[model samples]
Target: QDVFPSKGGSGTGASATRTDPVHELTPELRRARERLLPVIESLPGPIDWAVAYGSGVIHQANAAPSSPLQSPPMTDFLLSTPSPTQFHTSNIRSNPSHYPLYARLLGGSAVAWLQDRWGAGIWYVSMVRVHDLEVKYGVISTERLKRDLEEWETLYVAGRLHKPVLPLLTPPPLLPSLHANLLSALSLSLLLLPPRFTEHTLYITIAGLSYSGDPRMSVPGAENPDKVKNIVAGPGNLRGFRRLYGGLLDRIPGVRWEDGKVAEKGWIGFNGGDGGEGEDGEGWIVQPSSPAYLADLIPSLAPRLREGIAAHYRAAPPNDFGSGRGTEAGAGAGAGAGGTRRPYGSPVYHDIAFWERVVKDPQFRTVVRQELRKIMYRPALTQSVKGLFTAGLTKSVRYSLAKIGKWWKARQARSAV
Candidate 1:
């Protein structure tokens, strides 16, 4: 959207001749402004016009109360609508092929702009400005806005961006948290596995055989087929392993399985199996470059790692390593015709029950939040976390601005008082 309006429209030509000195914003605000401006400029099509909006503008009325710790707020921009519409229409009409590029450019511009300049705080204001301008200027259709909002909401829920409602809050510590949780779940699952059938050695062996030379499988003795099988085939143990896998899939961005190994490229793979024929077999492999690898690198996994371990347990003979029988019937059945049998006093049953309890338990949610914070805030995880945050933050600016309008106004009121 253009920040400048065209001549001869209702209030479009109105320009404030008055000039105020460009007051220095708090470092945070300054950073936000610096980041957002270029994005605005680079947005697909020229910015017809843009104006300052929200607390960035209102907070200017009086200097914020001096605080030793809190930083001053940043400036907000009110991008005009006609510019966006013209840009979109021109791009689509001129080269429909570029429509996707135009959208991508729009999204990228917003993201890059925010990443470089604004903190999460300014996102809300930006959204409000866009919404207000679109409604008032009739630039973007309501249908389009709704669709955009849906996409934005999906990103927020997936922890892709700082939540629009709480932009000031840091992005969700997904990778670290997932890592911790997966480990915990695994431990719990192992604890629950039936002792008679449970074999840590076997599990380690199987995993090792499967992973072999892959950096992700670098854990000592992880290659032993017996050890890996025990870990995989043992009672509740597999539950924890699956949870670990699933958690990795969720938290690690750009994770993909290639050449039978987990690797991170840019996003995580929700499913196993990279869809390639390997000399070894045809199961999904975890990619090493993925954020999940970080967990593997960590000294310990989270405590909740075991909670869901029971859910993945299989009651079957240990011989079904790659029989492909489980592939069609699912992993729950044991090898042989009688189906998997459970050993007496098997902790597998208990682990399964425990997992059930954990899923329904609210306490697990608290644990998740705690672990997430630990993993996300760690210095080592900063780069990937920042990348994910940047991806989400860009999409958030517009919507956050709309959602936080009232909050900004309230803050302005408090400052005024």
Candidate 2:
């Protein structure tokens, strides 16, 4: 459970920077932070951050209305460690059942190698029964986690974090990065969403970032189709959604809220005016203007977040109309006071029109969809491989049958259509 190397120093371990503002503890949040944190903290590893997500956490979120004895699906944790290989090497010895026989025997170095080389920067262990909770967890280096969350390099962890999660352990210094990641996810999702949409639809679009092109989606029940709607529909969850996006929404130009929800006329539009060239004079050539209210909300973001958005446009180039096409590389650029060409990229902070251009580009949307599909397929393939190693013959048989049945039904439905 004590994952950080030290409790006192600033050398990548939990330090003074990790402190959160004191809050009047609510029973729910107290149980999550106080009770659950101890359980995760007790797990053997050097953890920089750990969060419990998926249906198990959702059940916990909804537990106020349900019986405590009710069984939920396996609790899931996504852990960030300073060094995954070292963490897995030690973790396997303490919690051998958490990993497959091969992974345990091969040692932590192999675990780390496989995660980085073959899998997304994380390795997974499933079917772990710990502290009376059935759990599955994925481990990755803290550096890689932050990178993906910011740049969305794989959209694996990025997609997962887009949804609501209960953070059992987050050191104080890492808090800002986590919040920034969520903001980046929202911005990226907005870039893919239609110009006009409802809050529920907006959350749905955000949630869909993970599942957009997943191959498992071919089988209707492989992933819940109604997941996005459900995540934002329930009052408890809706509140969580609002907590995540509310302030950000309030600052977006042309986004209006009435009575704590998005109003009908809350259509997002860009104000075309000359602003500063992107942070570096080489990223995006021109910057989009923002209202005073919206500008105040911008936060410093990861360089890759801005760079990734720029990459999409830089590939196709944009016209003067901001259509994100044509060979006019200087289309969005504004001349410097010195009248020199300043090739700008997306700002490392908020750029509403930059994101809006991304959203409006058909080619960009296609690329996003393709990348999303890749991310989705990897999990399906990884889970199946892991299942063969970890699951009993009977459980595997039943799972295969269920998948077949679901797939057949889906095929039949399509045939009828």
Candidate 3:
């Protein structure tokens, strides 16, 4: 498979760019959004940008009938401002009760300090009720928002944005950044995915990045293992996912679509140096990356990656990215478990000699996985801890008990199985 195209596609083949989340709204979605108007309107301080996410948005978009047992899931907001300290300062006066007693006593600067310095780059105020609807809003500086989106440094807010998020208050200048950040996310996720995967699996992999190695997952039913899958597979969500990711999808060289789903054709790289094309000379499969492919790819991926990758590409082996040790036999043209003739090449292998040396290194994939995990794990654990405090005593206790109960049930079910 040719991971690197000779030319970059404009990312808009025949389809138009879908930049505005408003375009996705249906009557049902609109009505559902209406219910949160009070919550949105009640935000106390200035916001550079704010997005509404979580089960609340999904429920609204799906317009499922409400259940009395579940007071509509909290309308969650990931908000950004020019200055979190200033915003919180102003907001503290307007909504004093939203702050925990300690946060209030310490002041907004202290809250912001704790948020950015100790927890993830957000200070959340949960269980704030407005017009009979519960809401949880997290505030962060626009700087942190952009940094995380570009670098995946935290993968906290970026992960939430990966799923469908209703952009409520977007500044015009930030629109392009939002679009690019999402594309970068898709590109990174694609790199991490196994060569063979279904469309839904692709989204699941992306969604799962945020939760990778999260300790909460070990706590029985602390998190629904199916949460990511459900988000991607839910009504209207897959369409939303495609709309958000379609432009970037159009740019990938050999993505094959069938029955409205997409996957790599088969194998990667060329058998007999033929470039993975069939007799018809149409369609390409997902393959290992070549050095040249990686050369092109590093630049094409998120900007933060370019610096670390460029030197590796230039040196051509025996370095950080393992561009130094495998052979043509090791990197290309191998038999699969199913007895299929598969090219056994690194996803980024351009030179045969380089592949020969690099493949021997063995730590290449591990290094990449470790780097990605490090970005996600700490932030997730910090957020989990922060949630206990931000949720307040009553809400925190209730939430914890609910999680414990769910965990117990899941444990029991597993034992029964």
Top TM-score model:
3
Per-residue accuracy of model 3 over 246-304 as CA lDDT, tens digit each: 55666666544433222233322221111122122222235345444332333344443
lDDT per residue for candidate 1 within 1-417, as digits (tens), equals 112222221222444221111121234434544444453443344333333332332232233453889533444433333233445544344433322333445653443344223221111222222211321111222222222222221111112111011011111111233234333333323222222222233234323321222221233322222223333443332332332243334454333343423343211233222222112222333334322332232223222222122223242222322434323333343233335533322343333323333333334334433333332233223332342343246544443453355345544565777
Q: What is the clash count of model 3?
A: 30
lDDT of 1 at 141: 21
lDDT of every model, 2 decimals = 0.31, 0.54, 0.58
| Candidate 3 TM-score over all chains jointly | 0.72
Candidate 2 displacement at residue 375 in angstroms:
6.4
RMSD of every candidate to native, in Å, equals: 23.6, 10.2, 11.7
lDDT of 2 at 138: 78
When 1 and 2 are scored with lDDT, the better candidate is 2
Candidate 3, residue 212: CA error in Å?
1.6
Clashes of each: 80, 11, 30
lDDT of 2 by residue, 140-164 (tens): 7778777777655566786777776
Order of all candidates by TM-score, from best down to worst?
3, 2, 1
RMSD of candidate 1 to true structure, Å: 23.6
Tell how far residue 165 is off in model 2, in angstroms: 0.9
Instruction: Looking at model 1, report the run of 10 residues with the lowest lDDT sum.
Output: 162-171
